[model samples]
Target: MILLCPPGVYKAQSDTHLLAGRVAQLAHGRHVLDLGTGTGALALTGARAGAQSVTAVDLSRRCVATTRLNFLLHRRPVRVHRGDLYEPVRGRRFGLIVANPPYVPSETSVLPRHTRGRSWDAGPTGRAILDRICDGAPEHLEDDGTLLLVHSAVCGPERTLERLAAAGLSAEVVDRARIPFGPVMRSRAQLLERSGLIEPGEHLEELVVVEARRG
Candidate 1:
């Protein structure tokens, strides 16, 4: 599929492909929602996987437009919305929801505004958007629905599992990959280590795909 990622919109990366692989497994004939659908990678993946319907949501106008364009370019039918997580899909429910949110830990508690950094910087604990997704997903999911989320271990995968469990969904880490630090992570290695989020001299980060299912 031809995808055009304009400036300020996130280009699909390893984490995106990881989540897309998982989405391909469960999207057949199911209604799928791709939260934080940067570049519409996962959404298109779901559509191609035979999903009954696919809806994508992103907060960035650029991302929303890019996703729509990609869907059109590929001739995939996806409903694209521009809003915060779960906000655009209010009163709706889906059988599967996938998210590759901004999980990189930042030094400040305030999330970035007016910068491309908004695509990767979560707050100080890196739970700003992660926590919101974990909390809000259950309500948007049908009984027996599944939520696929990919994030860095530095943001605490256990916390994600626990939060989803607390919200009445059974959660587990289904897949993980150790990847070398990228520019964003490489630059913040020291700060992450100082914050005890990562071990000193640890240059590798584990990206995990957490699967949460509603009973």
Candidate 2:
């Protein structure tokens, strides 16, 4: 689908497409929530796939506006909100929750405010956002619902599984894709190598989709 992404809104990328396939398969007949909605691509996919309802949340005002506009342009039904992870939807639950949150390890913990880096920078261990999702997603899922998260293996998918499991959900790697470094990873290759996050000169990183549900 063609989306209007403003200057600061994240453009849908590999992770988005990866999670989208799962959305198409699992979103029908469910009330779906797309966290870190970016261009609302995943939420739109859910709506298109016949979801009972679709709500999207993003931390960026630009992203919220872009997504809302995109949905309007497509004449699809969606509720778009601007807020941090799970904040806007407090006390709400859904049948499916999907996120492709920021997971690229960055040098600092302070997230970028004015750049596109906000879309992927997740601080030193890249768990800043991932951990939050792991902790909060389970609480927001219906008893039979599922949470789907896509991120780089560099961020430690095993840890995600452990966290989700500890939170009372059964979690596992559902999908993986090894793609050449994008501009962000390419720029941080040397740093990642020095930090032992990746093998020296490793040009490809594996992306993983983690699926979680009530244990």
Candidate 3:
């Protein structure tokens, strides 16, 4: 319904909606956890799909507020928490977990702390947040639960599958979308090419949704 994204808050984009679609499909009867719930799109989708409960976590206060505001606007309920990934929901397991974290490959490996870059400036390999999510997801997912992660292919979706598999989860790419580079990707195109993450003159990136299941 109404999605108000202030200056610093992330606007719900294609990736967010893509994951939300899957959230709507799998969230029924589940306790859902949405990591990086920027605008609460996915969390709200989970609730709309009849989730038992929905909890959204974000490190940015602005994102947390925006997510809550969106929930209020739509009359949906959610537990919005302001904390880094998995920190606020420590030891709490969810029947379904969804994430659309930053997966843009940046110049350095260091993640942003307070700046707007924290929204999309993922580390050089773009696994800064992705890896952490993979490593921590197992403990936070109930048996038979599923984790849905959407990220750019340039950051290596296969690596995500590998990491999750190493963690004893059955993982696979469930969906993919190829779109022309957005502003951020256009700006970092040259760097990505130089770093061998993409081909020279490549103006498109494939966004993939990887689903990992705990059994």
What Cα-based lDDT does every candidate model obtain? 0.92, 0.93, 0.91
List candidate 3 segments past 4 Å from native.
Answer: none
TM-score, candidate number 3: 0.98
lDDT measured at residue 175 in model 2 versus the true structure, 0 to 100? 93
Worst 10 residues of 3 by lDDT: 1-10
Write model 1 residue lDDT over 1-62, tens digit each, in one string.
Answer: 56898889888888998888899999999999999898999999999999999999998888
Scored by Cα lDDT, where does model 1 land? 0.92
Clash count, predicted structure 3: 0
Residue-wise C-alpha lDDT for candidate 2, range 47-97, written one tens digit per residue: 999999999999888898889899999999899888898999999999999
User: Could you tell me which residue pairs clash in candidate 1?
Assistant: none
Stretches off by above 4 angstroms in model 2 are none
In model 2, what is the error at residue 145, expressed in angstroms? 0.8
Candidate 1 is scored at a TM of 0.98
Residue range 39-85, candidate 3, lDDT tens digits: 88889889989999999999999899999899999898789999999
RMSD of each: 0.9, 0.8, 0.9
Per-model TM-score on C-alpha atoms: 0.98, 0.98, 0.98
